[model samples]
Target chain A: MNVALRFDPVRLPDHCQDLRQEVRDFLREQVVQGVYDPTARSHGYEDICRFAKAVSERGWIGMAWPREYGGQERSFLERYVVSEEMLVARAPTRRYFVADRQSGPTLIRYASEPIKQRVLPQIIAGEAMFCIGMSEPNSGSDLFAAQAKATKVDGGWRLNGAKIWTTGAQHADYMIGLFRTSQPTRENRRHGLTSFLVDMHADGIKVSPIEMINGVMEFNEVLFDDVFLPDENVIGEIDGAWKQATSELAYERSGPERFLETFGAMRAFLTAVEGTDDTRLQEGLGRLIAQLHTMRRMSVSVAGMLEAGREPVTEASIVKDLGTVWDQALPKELRTLISLMDYDQYDVQAYRERMDFYTRMAPKLTIQGGTTEILRGIVARGLGLR
Target chain B: MALDSDDIHVATAERIFSDRADLQTVAHDRDGAYRASLWQAVEENGLTIAMVPEEAGGVGLTLEEAFSLLRAAGRHAVSVPLAETMLANWALAAAGLEIREGVLVPLVPAPRGHLAIDAEGRVTGVCPEVPFGREAGAFVALCDGPDGPVIALLDPAACRIEEGTALSYEPLDWVHVEGAPAMASAPAGTAAALPEMAATARANQIAGALERMLDATVQYAQDRRAFERPISKFQAVQHLLARLGEECAAAVAAAGSAADTLSRGETGDALLLEVAAAKVRCGEAAEAASGIAHQVHGAIGITREHALHRLTLNALAWREDYGTEAHWALKLGQLVSAGGADALWPLLASR
Candidate 1:
């Protein structure tokens, strides 16, 4: 039996270029106004919020959502253009990225009408920050192994357990957490888990920052010590989060962020080696650019699929697998490519700093969203091998 | 799967290829008997001249449709010069020349020793690695005309051919033309596009072959047993096959996008970037996939008896045909570098 794999050569819609330019202009203005340093590897908490709010004011966050929720009701392709431009420009999307990308959509789909009316608008307004609580200290890639309990109370669920590696948790206003509501059946190991919209500011929630190798304190160990979540905060069917989780993967895995994490290093390399007549340098840089372009095409194709209301799970996994792997190796590859060339010809300090930051950031690229092993398993299932 | 009007041609090509050019048949035939028959069937099905306009005495099909036919040809692992002939016919028609019947392989001469039109308008110079050159009734050469670039149909009988074969046992000959007689010649404004066209064709073919390889490897993994279970049950084997699937997807996306760009009449740096990136990406995928496909198959895949060679070897052979990955990589790299650091993202996002 043939596995039906379709990439479908999807080009961006004709009007996306205008939207892309609009995003570029807005980001340029941010840079000019000293809002965020494009050259910096990371930003402070206030910087991130200010930038996210500016983007939200432009109606870019949650752009594909309906107008009633403060969204622009734009096409996914338009949103894609906005997201990629923001990523490439190194705009601080830390505050609203998760909400705009996945959490907002999840809330709109599964949150109660009152919860949606309250939270979706806040997400659209960039007044809320969201973090994923799938990974625990025990379960990193194996999301089904989450041991966080959410026992039902009189009018709510009492949450207890720690979620480690929760990115931006310290600053998150809300968390779309996976909590165990029942024991997994022998037939389905992925059962018993339920997704809930946990209020981070609620009592019994403690967020402790986890410092990374790059000396950046981004991810946090979030402990849910009897945190109360009302019935309205429960998202989707109780103990049916597996179905919802898999569907959201297509949106999360295949985005510009998958590949553009090390774009600064590439830009630095280009600046360092600009005007070089050396053949080796050109060839090395060219292959990287080619791969980048191909990855973008695949990412855009996935966006096209999403726009057309098709869940391209397999295609999205493939894109993330290739894109993340390529991005992870890029810093080292660029290092090797520019090692032999004279450093004095370019901004050696800036290039070195960018490379240094990206080199530290590379290992987490594939591990963060979905590890290489997990993504490959998903792809194999898609290929009908398992 | 509803058959759209565009897919109708591709479907017919797929059907014809499966019937006459199935992997078992093509792999088993030592002689050219089966390949000859397959070529005959392909020509009879109007797949040979699909790129030429109907006004020029050939099937008027879009570039996308023609590419799909080539992709189907690739999936069957047919050794016929179908892609070359289609490209040659398209060039001939674009140049307002007569579209000849039979296998007329297009030659993108090596940059240094490329064929040229002399004072008497005859094609001259030594063009090497001319795929299926010996089997061709004529060689479609994009020559350097006195006025501009021109497309010249050179009679293969008049040329001295040094026969060669690729790793796949497909005909890849070197044709030396010392003022060879021109069957037809005309100024082709789009003559510079032949190389990119050829690259796009190879990219599509590589994409198709990769798909075939993935299918074959996945099936093999399922059937082959080890430790009382199918090899596919093993996580290692599944991951290898999954990696192969990723490469196949990348190739398909890159090649399909390039074909679309060419079909939409995009030219200049935009077309160059798309075609070059496609060739580079597909070539890289072929290299990576060929290894994974063979690794998954073990000893049997290396043997000539297995149909795996028919797909992998040809895909690898195409990596060097139009231009090696390094060759296109250099061109693309230079283009990107020349545009400077600030322009790279804009150029990439333009597509």
Candidate 2:
């Protein structure tokens, strides 16, 4: 490893490192052939996912999954390198990243063997997509008390509830949802919840798109009306959904992705502005870049922990809590410079689409995966605080 | 690239001190304990004598290794007078003076105090604001020599300490020094270097505490819900907390790097410029971070019962010490003004 490049010491497999060149080669080829525009990279999920699928075909998707699932049997380091490169490339991989990184890992850890065998291959192949169904109305912060209900039925259970602010659910194939299984009697309200892999296409499920502030329907409100599930679809032990899913969140919340959200924009802004004089942008950008480096180091350190077979729950919580906010604020600081700068190939509308889209979606990056508050509670608990 | 000893902050220094509640409690008092336990552990770990030449009855470690230790201290909030004592020992060692372990308070020149190198090789004077004066066993006295203010080591027994002053930490008092031994005079602003060194030290400490405070505040905001959601999800507060964190981190890197420059002996206006910039920025950054941290934390953070106050208090105290925002601003302003107007390019290029 080049010491200059070492912000944090997460282990990447020797092969994973080679994957960087592969991503670059492919991206370079696309750019050379005028097949993809770097300026339009972050705009649409479908376009971004198209690029992700290209990389996925090279055995990058679910790279660390078992070979039985058509995965490359690679390491987290390898997957991390690929993810980071995609961000640096400023290409959108929003569509399938969640399923591959956290949802797949969650299922592998707590899903029934049947569920894993059924879903892992498809997820690894980039054919099936999953969105989280944790947050809901009246329970946005208190996720466990979510009114999403799963009543007992003849063969399995009937799930009748709604999840709001669901990201990319309009396009997702399924949701790994945590619904209330047992009755909520103050004490057991949180403990009685169970997780299920609900097919979004199943009967009685409704997906209505929720346009974001930036005017995109990348997220939606997923309403479940007596959506039934087979008993075999239960994730982990009954009412242990919270436990099963919280582990996945640790994976979700940490890593370079949390903080690196706006690097492309920031870099684009940097390329736009040239004078290192007393301009506020230079000062702000300098501080921003330095701050970004620090967060990256912390995130990399957490990556190192996960690589060593440690969950690094508290550390990951710290990273996500810090990273998401840092990532989101970059554009707010750089918007002026971004306004001044122009891309070589992209027209104003194309560039505006990418910038406006990411800016709208920026707010949820912190709220989703895990809310800052919930992560802090975890950190406090890690500190043995009440 | 040659990394300055102060620039490299490593994590290996996590070994000696307690990262548990005991240290946190000591760090959180209405007036922190001055972290005596942590200080002792640091001394044993060779932080005090870490960079002294082996012949000087020390561990003889390189400044490169020591800076890594310093950065780790910044990260962990290890608040003892590590840098003050180190600068003192470095001065003493450079002077070829024999020494033993104890606190070395800093003395700002009294202005009226005259510097004289006696035939017997004894130097003496009275200076003001000798840091930790009431508690330290020795004082590094800065007095007006013919050339300028030269810093000399004074025996603690040779000076008289007054009652406690109006300081936040209620640290040791300033002393009136008379006759002290083994003193030597150097260039005019040699003693001024003490603040830069101290600035480097306190700035990092300031950065560390700011980091901890921001971290604790952010975590608290996220977990403690208000109006049906984590406060962190609120767009306004999210912006506030992110800015706070950025300020904290900028201080860390700037201060760490300035200390690195000083450690590498990048002297004169060049070194002073970086130090002054860092000092001013760090003071402002620390002040802003601590204030915003308390705001984000709210009433719960104000209680003596909460650990957040420890880092905040440390930040409040550290920023005021060595140099405040005004003090460094004046110093930097003088340099910038002297360099003429349209001067940022040359100044930056020189750096």
Candidate 3:
């Protein structure tokens, strides 16, 4: 009956610190080699995928997974170090991020041996990319309301529906898609859905890029017209994906990416304010940095909980809620502080551009993965309100 | 990451607070028995000197254990200077000064305060507001000495004391010193660290108070009916409580992280970053969650008879203790700016 939520202090161990430095050095070297431009603010498929391959060679992708699956079997804290470093450096980890964070782990937990043998190594090796096909046009936040169907066939299920706002779907080699495998019981609307590992290269699958407000083409509309997924592709129990999906959210919703999305803007803001005695600017940066530091602590705590085999669903949701909101506000808050500075004195034109880019990207922060509303609901349920 | 063996301390605190300092008991206690009994229990448990090293004639609990204890005191919104006394003993002990017993309040003179020590080691200064100061047997003052920082244990009987009250009606007294001889004075490194310690302590208390507020508000929402159903069933109410939950989580995380950092013996910018971040974050959370808690509770929440005000008002008052969010935020901002942009991430990731 205690409504207290726990986010225990989870300091990354010495190993994470060592891994962090290596990541920073690697990223710095990549920047020097023109593998990617930190100032460019965005990286395309080729640049990101190549960088992913290099990162994988360092045994970072799926570093927390088992060695038999081409992983280092490192702690989640170590993986967390790699993630936050990639994010802060703007290293375009999109190619391996999903797979490293969730998909590979999901496969390890539930995939068939052949599927695990085939996919996890590719995922760990950074050869394969994965996308989550959860949001249909009508069922973005209301995930259980997804009408995407997968009718049973002789040897598999035939998928027929569409998933919108699927990030990186165009280049995805696989998708952990949620589809209707049975009718919903009156008692439980969430009981009917099933999750499948669909081969993206299948004949009936189609991927169309969708441009976002930030001018990024990462979002996609994936169409499944008779796209067949074999029996082995089913993850865990059929018609019980609600259970798996809920568990997966703890990993997806809490991460450095939730709060560090607009870190570039913050870094630029710091550059602009450096060597200046502007109280307003310093105070602004201080507040943001404080919030950012706290978010990282919370995120790390959740990661530690996961490492210890505890399901910190509520804590993870709270992280995403607070983190996304803070990240979303970073640009707007920076803009106010920037207004107080003399542009010519600070030489902040590039900083201004970074702020603009983050401003456009901010809207989706609380919407993707889990909308703020949905996250709040999850937190509410955690509070025993539901 | 669970408290594990530290659970004994938290559980002890929980037991003590529930028995002697429950909201209703403290709210309506006209005879001051509740406050006195709570203090007695805390003292009996040897919690006041928990931060002082065992070799220094005290319990010598780890800073982490002590903080968890403070947070437990916070859950009941106990309006005593438990944190101040613990911190005072800690500072005195760290300075190798004899630990003072009985209601010891701390005084870390504001940057602008007139508190000073002359060559003769006589204390001359004024602390405009000190929580539980009127009742303190002795005052632990961290001030500038001619050579460096010094920690002085001052006898209240020699100094002028005036009683005041915070918004929560707890004792917020004023103390004046006209070159009063210190009972004991020692050159202390803890002087410079006092503010951060005090702020971190307040952050821990605020985090605890916020958690209690969330608990109370959520309970109230469920029990209070509106439009033919429990108000909690409404999405608006649930979301507000949810946001309150978020604030509580952030506050706890921030405070806990700061406590962990201090317990590890970190100092300088490393210590400043964590403590400043904790104070600022917890202060913000207190302000935010306090309002949401009241909003969810409605008219009764504002009434004196209601216990909700104790938690909310104390949280607000604690937000100003040691340093307000703005105070620490500005300090933190200056620190970050000094490090420059390139060094910022490394500073944050240092933990």
- RMSD (CA, Å), candidate 3 to true, equals 1.8
Q: Rank candidates, TM-score, best first.
A: 1, 3, 2
Q: Candidate 3, clashing residue pairs?
A: none
Residue A106, candidate 1: C-alpha displacement in angstroms: 0.5
Give a tens-digit lDDT track for model 2, residues A1-386. Answer: 00011112232455655677787687777667654587653356566566666767777789888777677667776677777777666666766788888888877878888888899888877777788887887778887668889998999999997898788888788898888877655766568888888888899988899866655666788888888899888888887676666566667877777887765665444433433243343445444543454455456556766776876676677778878877887667666644544465223344444456568677777786777776656655553333
Tens-digit per-residue lDDT, A253-274, candidate 1: 9999999988888888888887
Model 3 segments beyond 4 Å from truth?
A: B1-6, B31-33
What is the DockQ of the complex in model 2? 0.06
Compare candidates 1 and 3 on TM-score and give the better one: 1
lDDT of 2 at A94: 69
Q: Which segments of model 2 are wrong by more than 4 Å?
A: A1-22, A33-35, A41-49, A151-155, A225-228, A335-362, B1-47, B52-204, B207-285, B288-351
Please give the lDDT score at residue A102 for candidate 3.
Answer: 91
Report the C-alpha displacement of residue A206, candidate 1, in angstroms: 1.4
TM-score of each: 0.97, 0.64, 0.97
Instruction: Calculate model 3's interface RMSD in Å.
Output: 1.3
Evaluate every candidate with DockQ and list the scores.
0.66, 0.06, 0.76
Q: What is the interface RMSD of candidate 1, in Å?
A: 2.2
Return the top candidate by DockQ. Answer: 3
TM-score of chain A of each: 0.97, 0.86, 0.97
Worst lDDT 10-window in candidate 2 chain A? A1-10
Model 3, span A1-386: residue lDDT tens:
27868888988889789989999999999999999998775688899889988998888889889988888888888888989998889888888889888998888988889899988989988989999999998889888999999999998989999999998999998999999999999999999999899999998998999987777798899999998888999888899988887788889989989998888888888888887788888888788888999999999989989989988899999999999999999888988898898867897787888888888777888899989999999899999899
